[model samples]
Target chain A: MEMKKTILNPEGLHARPAGQLAKVATSFKSKIEVIFNQKTVNAKSAMSLMTLGIIQSSEVIIKADGPDAEEAIQKIATLIDNHFSV
Target chain B: MSLKIIGQKAAPGMVHGPIFIFKKGNSEINRSHHLFSDFDPSKETLLFEKALYKSLQDLENLKNKFTSIDKEKIDIIEVHQSLIDDPEVKEQTLAKINHENKFAYVAYEEVISLFKNMFSEIEDSYLKQRVLDLEDISNRVLFYIINPELNFSYFSYSQLNDSRPSIIISEDLTPSDILGFEKTKVLGFVLSKGSPQSHSSILARSMEIPCLVGAHELETLDLSKYTDLILDTENSEVILNPNINEVKSFEEKVSLFKFKQKQLFSFKGKKTETKMGKLVPLGANISGPLDIDSVIKNDAEFIGLYRTEFLFLDRITPPSEEEQYETYRTVFQYLGHKRIIIRTLDIGGDKEAPYIRIQKEENPFLGVRGIRLCLKEIELFKTQLRAILRASNFCNDLGIMFPMVSTISEIKEAKKIFNTVKTELEQSKIQIGKKINIGVMMEVPSLAWILKEVSDEVTFISIGTNDLFQYSNACDRMNNQLQTISSPTHEGFQRFLKFIVQEAKKNQLHVGVCGSIAHHPEIMPYLISIGVDELSMTAQNILTVRAQIADL
Candidate 1:
């Protein structure tokens, strides 16, 4: 699957969105990877995401692969679009 | 009478003799030579195996010698023991010794040196600390292989575990390693290698045990010589080798300290009201679920600010909702119908959350964070709120509050979410009890101007003066280049809080300061004077603050 690029809404992905992304990432059967800068981590792992320590409105790349890879990336993109504010 | 080092007297008593110092790194690095070269595949495998067993005994003996079991030291020994017994370290070295005609020392060096290089390449900090442990183990192995039956019976522990309290002098202590000392038996602690924030020191303070660190480099400092000691609590000073006159002075001061403490304790469960019958509530800032003990022991009437951040830090995984539920449940049960105002996840400032990735902001303090983070992360927020709501059922007086609130909209938004969670749990038939009151921190400037409008939406208000002052003058409180926000004595902050106090009273809502300003002895009387209902602070500052408030 191709990587999707998005500006992190609601400043950067803070405690809340990091948690939201973790929760959502855990929901699907597909494996999701989020890359910010050069660091890549499992988007489903809060521990891994937290270690990224990104701030507001950062450019983040979400990559996913599996049975629902397209749907997972779509859901994540929508979450970044909807839940994480301008 | 021997060469005396006036080190921190870790225990009380007297011992007179030539003092022997336990020196570290004294064992030479080349001590590994014979163990490596002599362990030939054809002959010395059995001898090599015999040496491994002997080293374990040496470790056991060293532990028995210590005033306490040094876990780091034990950890080091275990690593070395494991390495020696490993199939690679011994079998490979011995094979090389026999096949290649290498010396036993050369064979041994190859085994351990490989581990040393491997350890240096690992990236993790915790894993890196293990390299030192490995080296320490290597030293023990060298001693065990070379000396054979040089029994480590030289160490003694007659004075330790003698039913008398001790002032342990150590180079360092691990966070978990401090538990071996019986609390009552550890009168004080002095670390040659620790700080105010070290686990031992923090544990000592929480236990009300006196401690002083960074003055204990004299490891062999005669503990017996310094045993006639008194801990000067106020100064963190250990008065060593006290004469009769010095003892008399401390003894005289001891009663005065007791009397002062008695005065502080007299306010137990008492209203913060003056003789004039004005109610003045005293509260505390708690970091975790465990800090409630200090709050209860101090008899704090309520929890002012329950910092919910420590729940996330240093943990392997995020605390599940059930874990959060049990945690909050304990706080609620402990307080029992007393107001415990929990501040939700007030991170993204100096107290950063490791579990959440927030990008680097030019000014994180001014950036979108705090209550803002709460609104954006609904699932996590929902988990916390649900846990909190679940806990509130167990304690009717439990309350929740949001921190760094800048807008009335945030208050309205939180109230809405709180209701949604309450309803969701109700729909699930989760058997939660009682709806808890919610409050918003009035730290923003515009909120100060619009208190009547703001107070109508919330159950109570807490003035976060540390940030309120910082925001009021646009000064980063930590910035040395910026203007200082000193104390209540500062005219501007005094005015800001005064405005908050006056506005809060007019709106008929309870408001209190929960910043360091709350615990300031100098500021307490003024806060009382300004008509704030409650004062909340870190638990350690409560007793002295209560004393200062009693006067007003």
Candidate 2:
């Protein structure tokens, strides 16, 4: 399953939010990856996500594969919607 | 040949010392690693995983042990922790160990360098900063992998063995990395990559260590060729392998700077009185307890302006009464015997909290802010008042100041709320302090002319000159084009301030100037002569202001 979303954080996917996003990704029993600017990185790795340099309003495609793929994608999409405040 | 590198001054000082080229990671591992003839990928993989786990534990321990007053510092540690927890780094290192037949530590090092090189190419500075955090964790993990028994988590000066006074030159340093170095042995720092706003540079400034950041030319220099170095932050440059003449001139500058500092230190315990023997109390304007050390160091007579906005800003929710009370009590407890004047939430204008709902106006500075905002949000005002009144029990001399007060009615409304909170606390048998003074921040220009009208409502007035000057001239102080017109030394501004001070005196209201202009060398003498009762400034300016007062 995959879904597209735009980052709303003023600071983009910086350390704190990236860590938070990764923490949420790690919860589901699925392989999740974030694709930005044609570059795909493991969503469960904050360092890999940060390597994308995703800034505010950057569009990214989140892809998840496994039994819990749909749940994983939905959770990550919601996290981005909240500007990664959690 | 002497090499000169220009950079931004992170801190002010002058020093000459032997140059020490400090590298972050353990370089010994690179030399010791050899071509493995009979390689065991599984064993090496196991070792790598153990190192990673141990490194994570070390970071967790550090995070647990750290009790920093600044929440930002702890956030840095958490970032480092998450950086280590990245599955990509572990996966890449394990893959290298299993497939390429590399040593455990070597595989980890290669993986880290790959990420570091990738991050280095990034133009976004905030993302680029992660490279340093990457290095910090890599150093820790590598240290644990090689020398687990040593239990060395931080890079220390003892590793160098040579104890000669030196200026540390590095690619960049983390806050933890800088803290690990021996302060007495390090004369200064020259970083090839970093900004003055980096945590490391801020730490350097607070530590009073001379540092130059963003010295790109430093990366090109062959450090071994430069045995001696001169770090002159006043000029925002470092001279490596200085010539005989350069050394002599640097020595003279160092002594003169030292002499000036020594002279200022002598005025610490002395009375803040002018040559004419007119005494005035010099106080520090602090945001929170983090600045308490500096406040005591500079020998401030009192905390004239404690901006309480720090507690309100940068958080999603407003601080509860209990949290606010605890913070105020801690500050008051720390500054025992010394009088403390705390200003209520002075938000709006330049500072905006997302939690506080205010209409978006074209001009925020002229819109609802400070006391005006408080007046509208009665509950918010009362909660803060309740906290302050509760904390007053711990303080011998505490003053509650209302900011952005313009009209006499605003002052009356605020005091009325303050009295209601006080009575409520009293009815609950809360024993508040007796001699707590209520004051107003005289930032609104109109309030100055009407000081006498509101004299009975407020006990004291602290002139916030920055806003007063900006509002008086109708010029934005931050706009670079208006710099000349917004100058504090403008005759009208000076005369206006003099009038405010004179009015406060006539009303028997103790007045202090708690703004950038208080420490202005050209204006401090004039203010002293005009009978200003107190001049409040940042902790760093205390001694200099005291010295200036003595010379007046």
Candidate 3:
């Protein structure tokens, strides 16, 4: 599996919803890399997302490769598409 | 095999409606960024005025809705409206639109940003909601301003074919959304945002709805796939996409819950006493008159603590003594002279009071707050005292409590003001409750340690556990690192209670807990066992507290 970047438009990965996305992304037996701007980071990192201070209309790219690549992409993409609001 | 459900259960009823997620989509407008950049200054000014007019009109509509109280909910709209009308907010909007010659959308964005920063900085959850409510309203206002013709309808669960909603999942819910929903038809509420402290959670507690917040994998839920679901607020877990047996058990539990509620409500108007013959005077702490009806329904022994701070905060100045007096009189009259203990201005520390400015100390927990500030600012204290006293004659059982009393001198100073207010009311030839019971809080261990001495001066003592525990352990309960440090079940705290209990007995004075611990069920039994004379807690827990006491 190859990693690709996507732009994040919704203001900051705020509160715990960001951490939640990270947690869900890491739950699967997959290697996920979430790159935000110039900083490349792990998708499973709460601290990383918190430090990024990703504001609304910012962009982030999520790339994952695993046995369940389809499940990983589908779930992560759905989570992001929901504006990471939930 | 199941879709996930996560939300704060707002009101308890089962609904099987299709999931209609209320996304609050942005209302699109015809104006483009390029068009706005090229627009004439005169046109921009007109646009700003138009948007401002719409905002003001919406605010007026909100005022009528919140103030013209038809049902139970408080006029929280008034609180938000005050924020909207705040000088700081107004100045910011004026600067952004008129001075900067910015687009109406940019001006709105700047205003929202200002609110988000201001509200997020404050410590209290209830007050924080004040900011969030303002933000929500501002967002809605912006949405309408952008597209006046936009059709906006967002409900997490819709009643299709007139069936009850099965489960509602959301990121978070506004206070209005929770109140407007058909509570009886909603089975479970799960949210991506908010928890026990959020507005939705508080309402859910009020309605006894099964609510869960900060749950895992809610966004992953495809609720339409589920035929059977279980929404349990107590557990903060929703069992979705369940099998037949799980559904049967949940339905049985619903019936059982109804039976239990019947048993609970039967004791509604009756006194809450234990089987062991302990006179546990159950009183509800109220902040508003709307709460008085609940006190009546719950058969509250008395209004333990009437928080007067809510009236004082946010506004440019404190409410007029007449306004405060009238408000107090209404609640006191409604309760029919029941023992209503009015705690005077327990602001500062974590609570943000813009009117009464205090120097920002290094540690607010150890700063001059509560009684200290009240004593230092005698005029503020006198106004509040006079309001309570004027309402005193209207209600006979008017009691007063001074919070954050760390020493006897603080009580003495507070009492001196109390006496002055009493004499002033009398000297003015206004009839008042001459012999009112004045009490001091045992939040500081030093006060608890010397309760025997000060206990004689005041008629009674109320312990504020949230602060006491924090001070005793030298830990901030809100600090994630020290979260484990707080627990009443811990010995240092249990020992503290034991000391206070024995001290109250020694003084032959009454003792009650007006803290968060008063409602903690795990601590309640231990509290009763430890000689806590009276337990004053949240209104929602009063019934359950009574139930547990009955079980005892």
* Candidate No. with top DockQ: 2
Q: In model 3 chain A, where is the ten-residue run with the lowest total lDDT?
A: A7-16
- Judge candidate 3 at residue B352 and give its lDDT: 57
**Model 3 clash number:** 30
Query: For residues B1-552, could you state the per-residue lDDT of candidate 3 as single tens digits?
Result: 644455544443442223434454444434464353664555655654555556556545544644322222354443334334343444566577667877666776777775566446644343355556765556655655465544222222243215655456667877656655666666556676776656566667556556667765766665456555566654445666666676677778778877877787877766778897777888888886657657877778887888888677554345656557778777767874678788888887556554566887788778888898888778778988998888888777767889888887788888888888888878899988645788877788777778777866888888888888888888788888865666666887888788888989899878888888888878888888888888887676688788888888
Candidate 2 to truth, TM: 0.71
Docking class of 2: acceptable
Residue B421 lDDT in candidate 3: 81
Ranking by DockQ: 2, 1, 3
DockQ of candidates 1 onward, in order?
0.04, 0.25, 0.01
For candidate 1 chain B, the 10 contiguous residues with the lowest summed lDDT are: B12-21
Q: After superposition, how far is residue B144 of candidate 1 from its true place, in Å?
A: 15
Q: Summarize candidate 2's per-residue lDDT along B190-232 as a digit string, tens digits.
A: 9999888787987787678999988999887677777888999
lDDT string, candidate 1, B399-507, tens digits: 6889888888888898899899999989998766565677888888888888887878887888888888778877767777664453346877787778888988999
- lDDT (10s digit) by residue, model 3, range A1-86: 54453534222454344556766876788877777767765666543454455554466777787798778877887776665544
Please give the RMSD to the true structure for each candidate, in Å.
10.3, 7.1, 17.6
Off by over 4 Å in 1: A1-86, B1-159, B175-177, B195-202, B214-255, B314-319, B377-379, B474-485, B540-551
